[model samples]
Target: METSVFTRSIESLLDEDEYRALQTHLVENPESGSIIPGSGGIRKIRWGLKGRGKRGGARVVYFWAVRRDRILMLYA
Candidate 1:
């Protein structure tokens, strides 16, 4: 996974455990997120906060680089 785009400020959006969970989920299912229309294959996944449900959670945007076998975490 290429998370260099996820800076300190971005990481702060979620706690350590939440971030780790996101990473694990992405690693296990990189193409599970819904693709964004007209974004050149970018995908988005909803991640719930510790107490909130998916509706009130953050939206993680990423791209699955199939050819490179990598996930490019873009935003959250």
Candidate 2:
């Protein structure tokens, strides 16, 4: 996984298992998130926290580069 300062900061807030699960989910379904308009194709997915349901989960913003098979996780 590629890491940026922003992403690393967000990752710091997640447990190891949560981070791994998120990585696996994105790899398995790159198009899982909804595209953000006017953002050059950035996408956002709502990920559930340990005890929180989807309604209270964190928002993960990312960009999926299909050609390179890379997921640029931007924010959380």
Best by TM-score: 2
Cα lDDT, all candidates = 0.84, 0.85
Off by over 4 Å in 2: 1-3
Which residue pairs clash within candidate 1? none
Among these predictions, the greatest lDDT belongs to 2
Candidate 1 TM-score to native: 0.85
Q: What's the lDDT for candidate 1?
A: 0.84
Residue 47, candidate 2: C-alpha displacement in angstroms: 0.2
lDDT of 1 by residue, 1-76 (tens): 5456655435767888888888899989998899999999999999988788999888888999899888888877
Give one digit per residue, the lDDT tens place, for model 2 in 1-76: 4557646766666788888899999999999999999998899999888788888888898899988889988888
Worst 10 residues of 1 by lDDT: 1-10
**Least accurate stretch of 10 residues (summed lDDT) in model 2?**
1-10
